[model samples]
Target: MKNLAESVNIEAAEIMKIFQWKGTTDQLTDEEKTHLKYEIADTLIYLFYMCDQLKIDPVDVMKAKLEYNKGRHWKKDKE
Candidate 1:
C-alpha cells in the first residue's frame, strides 16, 4: 500500500512538471515523454499489485465509480 501511494505521488509530480515546466505536454522532449510514460506505468503496476493483494477487481471498482460519478456534478473552475 505504501508503494502504491508513493507511485501515485511520483506520477502526479511528473504530470505536474508538464504543466509547470512547459505550457503543455505536447512539447515535451522525447526523454521527458519517456519518463512520464514510465511513471504512469509504475503507478498502474503498483495499483494492480495492491489490488491483487487485496483480492480486488480494479475493473469492477472503476465501473462502479464511473456509474456513481454519473449522478454527481462538478463545478468548472473559474478561469
Candidate 2:
C-alpha cells in the first residue's frame, strides 16, 4: 500500500515476525537479535521516508515527543 500508515504497520509486522510464538522477547536471542536489527532498520527507513514526505523533521519531532513523554507518570522500575 502507498499509505504511510499502512507502510508503518507492514514494517512493524515484519519486525514482529521474529518474535512470533516466542517468550521473553525482551531478551532477544542472538539469532532473533540479528533479524530484528534488520527489520528495525527497514522500519526506520520507512519512517524517514514518511518524515520527508510530510516535510517534517524527524529529529525535532522525536525530541519533542520525548520531552512530552518525560512529563508522564510512567517512570520507576518495578522493584
Q: Candidate 2, which segments miss by more than 4 Å at Cα? A: 25-27, 75-79
| Candidate 1 similarity to native, TM-score | 0.72
lDDT at position 70, candidate 2 = 79
Give the Cα lDDT of each candidate.
0.79, 0.85
Q: Once superposed on the true structure, which residue ranges of model 1 sit more than 4 Å away at CA?
A: 24-26, 77-79
Which numbered prediction scores highest in TM-score against the true structure? 2
Models 1 onward score TM values of 0.72, 0.78
Give the per-residue lDDT of model 2 (tens digit) for 1-79: 2787788888899988888877783677898888888889988888998999989999999999999997777647433
lDDT per residue for candidate 1 within 1-79, as digits (tens), equals 7877787777777677655746544587788788778877877887788899889999999999999998877776433
Q: Per-prediction count of colliding residue pairs?
A: 0, 0
Candidate 1, residue 33: how far the Cα is off, in Å: 1.3
